[model samples]
Target chain A: MGEFELIRNFFAAAPCAQGGEGVALGIGDDCALLAIPTGEQLAISTDTLVAGVHFADPCDPFLLGQRSLAVAVSDLAAMGATPIAFTLALTLPTVTTDWLQAYARGLSLMAQSCRVALVGGDTTRGPLSMTMTVFGRVPNGLALTRSGAQPGDLLCVGGELGNGAGALPLVLGERTAEPAIADPLLAHYWSPQPQLALGQALRGKATAALDISDGLLADCGHIALASKVAVQVECDRLPLSSALVAFLGKAGAQNAALSGGDDYVLAFTLPSVELPPLLAEGWPIHVVGRIVAGQGVTLLDSDGQDITPQTRGYQHFRESP
Target chain B: MGEFELIRNFFAAAPCAQGGEGVALGIGDDCALLAIPTGEQLAISTDTLVAGVHFADPCDPFLLGQRSLAVAVSDLAAMGATPIAFTLALTLPTVTTDWLQAYARGLSLMAQSCRVALVGGDTTRGPLSMTMTVFGRVPNGLALTRSGAQPGDLLCVGGELGNGAGALPLVLGERTAEPAIADPLLAHYWSPQPQLALGQALRGKATAALDISDGLLADCGHIALASKVAVQVECDRLPLSSALVAFLGKAGAQNAALSGGDDYVLAFTLPSVELPPLLAEGWPIHVVGRIVAGQGVTLLDSDGQDITPQTRGYQHFRESP
Candidate 1:
C-alpha cells in the first residue's frame, strides 16, 4: 500500500472512526453514511485552519488536532444540534508517523468527548492546513438561529469569555506566568469545549443564538443585523474568568472580552420567562446585555454611556478598499 | 465590513448559495441546515485541492472552482445518492476581486448543473487551497457500497475514460495538439460530469460501485479487497474516447485508461440480467471484465494472460514501506 493509503488506514483505525450511533458507514468509503431520524434537520458547518495563519507553525499536532475539531463543532453547538459526525481534510507538507499517531489520538479523544464519529476525508500533500466539516441533527423548526431575537430579549452567555484570546501571549511564548494561571488559560485556548449541552437545552428557548468566535461585540453585531434589532452590551456584566483576569488586568481582560476573538462561548438572546427555568436548572447562563429596538450593536458603560472602541474584533484580511 | 466579510458576501450572493430543495438554510449563518426526507440516509464526503500539488498554482480560478466541487460530488454519485448541498472552506494568500468573481461564477455554474446547493463555507488567509464537503441522500439500506460484488457479476464503466490523464501533457504546456483533440481532453480534465442519474438508476441493480478517481485497475483492486473477490479486466475491451485515442495512440491511450487518476466515471459490478436492460436504456454501460473467486485485481491480455502493470495508479506520498 502507498503511504497515503497507510495514513488513511491509520485514521480508519482510530477510535473515533469506529462505528457510532448515527453513522451507517464510517471511514474507508467514497462517502460516509449518516442516518438522520425523521422530523430532524441536519446542521453542517466547515472550518479551516492554516499554519502560521490560524496557529503557530511549530505548535503541537495533538493540540492542533483537538482545537481544529473543537472550533468546527462549536458551530453545531450554536445551532443547538446533537453531534453526529465530522470529516477532516488534512493537507501536510510531509508524512511523519509520530505526528499522525499523536494527531489521531487527540482527534479520537475529542471525538469521544463530543460523541462525534470521524467520517471519511481526503489527505493531500501541500502547505500545512486542515479543514474540518462537522454535522449534527436538530429537531425541525426548533433550531436556534441568529434571526429570531425580539426587541425585549435578554443577551446571555454560557460561560466565561476571553480566555482563548488571553492565552495568545502564552501560546506564542511572549509572556510567562505561574502554572496555575497559565495552565487554565492555555487549556482554554487549546481546547475550548463546545457548549453542546447548553445549546441543546436552549432549543425552543433562545430567540437568537451564536457561539462567540469573532469576539462578543462583533458576533452580537451579526445577530443584530440578522434579527433587525439592536444588541446593547453592558461592559460591567462581561464574564471574565479568574485565570483570564489574573493573567491580563481587569481593563485588559475587559478589552479582550469585548474585541479579542476565539472565545467559542455561546452568546445568545433569551426571553425573560425562559431564563428563569434555564438558570434554575444549574446552567451557566450569564446575563451580559439586552436586545433593544434599534439597528446595530452598542457598547454601554456602567453610566449608560456609549463607550464602543474603534476596533470591534479581529478582521482576518485587510484588503485594498 | 472587513474584506473577508465582503468575500463572504460575494459567495453568499452567488446563485448556488440561494436556497434549494433540501437546504433548510444556506449562507449567512453559523451552520447550514439540511432536511433529508424520511427513510433516507445522508451521504457525506470531503475533498481538498492544494494549489501546487493538485493543480497549477497560477491556473484559472474558474476551472479550479469547477474541478474542486465536481471531484467531491463524484463521491455521492459513487454511493448512488442524489446531490443535496456542499460547503467550501477556501484559504487564499490574498484577496483579489477578479479571482473571487470568476471562481464564484464557475462554482455556481457547476453547482447548478449538478443540482447541488452551496450551503456554507469559511474564508481564511493562507496559502491557496480549497476543501469541498458534499452532502447527498439515498433511501435507507439502498446506497451502493464496495463490499457487495458477487463472484458472478460483470464489471462495467459508465462511459469513456483516459481523457483526463491524456490531457495532462497539454495542460502543463509540454505538448500541443489540434483544438479538436485538446479541447475535448481538457474539458474532460477540468469538468468531468458526475453520473448522478446513472448512479441513482443503479441503486438496486448494481451490487458494488465507486467513481474511478484512482485509475480503473487500482480502483478495481479496492473493490476486490472490499468484496473479497477478484476483478479481471479484459484489455481488449477497455473503453477509450476518440479525443484521447487521437492525442495518444492506441497503446498509450490504453495505458492511460488503465491507470489515469482523474476519470470520475463510475465503475460498478452488475449481474448479467441487469446489464441488458441498462444497456437497452442507453446508459453508456461498457462491460470490460468479470468478477471471480479470487483475492485481487488482474489485467488480462487478449489471449487471457495476466499482464497487470507494476504501477497500478498514482499514489500520493511515496514514503518508505
Candidate 2:
C-alpha cells in the first residue's frame, strides 16, 4: 500500500472526538484544523520517546502507544489546561499489521479517555521512536505555572510517587513481581492517569504546578528554581503506596518516592487558606513540605536532619551509578 | 551541565513572540499556556526529519535546521492558515556547541521569517532527529482542504519545482556541480521557502490547497482522490528552473519534478476567474493543468500526447528500483 493507504489503515480509523468547538477538521487531511475560542488560549507541548531509552525494546506495542500519548498529555495537565488535540510522529523500523493494530488500540483508548482528538502527523521508516505533540486550551491568564510559588506555601503532590520507578525492576526482569506490588507499579508506568481534572480545578487555587517526571526532589527543584524559592521537603510526609511499602521496606520505599521518576503526579504549591478544601477532597495529595525564602532545595527528616543526596533523583545525560 | 541546562542554553535562548492571541506563556516552563481565540480554530501539523533518512547525515546543520522547520511550516501552508506557535522536539547523539549554535541560528532565522513563536518542547539524548509541531489559526470556515477541488478548477503551482530533487545527486556526491547550477539547487534543497503567504492569501480563493512535498504527480493525486476528480497536466507547462533544466536536461528535470520529494511549493486549484493577480506581484505561479471528471492523473506533452508516468513520488516503505 501507499503512504496514504497506510495512514488510513493505521491512524485514520482511530477514534476522535466529533465536531468540537475548536476542531473544525479532525483528521484525514494534510493538516488538522482547529477553531480556538475567543477568550481562551492554546497550550502546546512536544515530547519524543525512543524505544531502548524510554521503554524496553520488547515491551507491548499497545502499552508503548498509551504511555507515549499519556506522557505528552501530562504536560497539558501540568499547565492546568484540557487536552484538545494531538499529533503523533511515529518512526518505525518496519510495518507489522499486528503491531500497528495493538499500538493504535492503545493510543485510541487513551485518546478517548482523555477526550483528545488525533490530528495530523507523519510516519516514517527509521529506528523505533514516537513523538507526540499535544495541544490544550485554557482561559487567558488562568493556567497554572511553575513560577508562582511563594514562601510558606504548602508543597503538595497528587497521588503516590515512584510507583513507576519502583516497577522498573520488574519490567526489566531484574526483580520478581509480587502480585500486590507489581500490578500497581506496572499499571502506573504503562498507563498513567493524567490529572487533568485536578489540574483544571486547581487552576486559580494553586500557586504553582508541575507533573513529577524527573523524580520528586529533582522536579521540586524545578518549581523552586522557577518560583525563585527554596523548598523544604519533609522526608516523613512523602506519600508511599501500601504496596510499595510492603515490597520494599519503609526506607527503601522512601528512597524510591524521593528519587524515582515517571510518577506523572502533579506536584503543586498552594497557600494555607487554599489547602483545606483541596486536602478535604482526599485526592492523595501529600503535604510534603513548604516553600521557603531561599534559593535551593533541602530535604529535612523528622528530627530536622538534612537528607539531600540520598534522595536526589536521576539527571539526564549523567551516567547512573 | 545537565541535559536541561544544555537545552536552556541552546534551544531556549532564541527570542519568541511575547504576547500573541493564543500564547499565554511562551517558554521556560513545564508547559506553555495558549489562549485560543473565540471564533477561530487551531490548525496542527507535525513532522520529523531524521539524520540520513530525511537529510544527509553530514549535511550543514544550519540548513538542516532551516529545512526541518520549513518543511513543518509547509503543513500550515497547505491548510491556508496563519502561523502562530511551534514546539520542537530535538534528539541529538552528542552535545556539540558548534552544531547547536549553527542549528539554533537557522531555526531562529526561520522562526523570525515565519513569525512563529517557539513555545515549548523536549530535548533528549538519542540518534539525531528533529520533530516540530506547528500551530496556526484559521478563520472558522475559510481553511483550505484537499477535498475542495472541483472538476473544472484550474491547477496551479507556486514557484519552480525539481531544484531540490535535482540537487540530491550533488548533495550525495553522485554528480559534480558547476558553480552556476550548484548554488541555486543547493539553496533550493537546503533552505526551502515555505509558501505560507501564498497559502494564506489563497484561503478563500483556492478550491483546494496542499504543499508539494512528495512531488507534483503524487500530491496532485492526493487532491484528485480527496476531491473525487481527475487531474491533467501539460508537461511543457511544468515550472522548471533554468539551473535544473541545464544541469539535468529537460526530460530528466521533468522526471525529477514529477517524481521527487522535498519541494515545499504550493500546489492549488483556483476557479476559472481572474488569475488573482499573483503573477503581477512577482509571485511565480505556473498554470499547469485542470481538474477533470475522471479517476486518476494524466499528463499531456506539447503535442497533446499523453506522457505522464504510471508511478509518482517516493513511498516510505517501498524499495528504490
TM-score of each: 0.98, 0.97
Model 2: how far residue A260 lies from native, Å:
1.1
Distance (Å) between predicted and true CA of B149, model 2? 0.7
Clash count for each candidate, listed in order shown: 0, 20
- Most accurate candidate by TM-score: 1
> Which ranges in model 2 have alpha carbons more than 4 Å from their true place?
A17-21, A310-312, B16-22
DockQ for the candidates, in order: 0.80, 0.74
After TM-score superposition, the amount by which residue B194's alpha carbon in candidate 1 deviates from its true location, in angstroms, is 0.6
* Top-scoring candidate (DockQ): 1
lDDT against the true structure, per candidate, is 0.91, 0.85
Model 1, residue B169: C-alpha shift (Å): 0.9
Residues B86-190 of candidate 1: C-alpha lDDT, one tens digit per residue: 999999888888898989988998999999999988998889999999999999999999999999999999988788889889888889999999999999899
Q: lDDT winner among the candidates?
A: 1
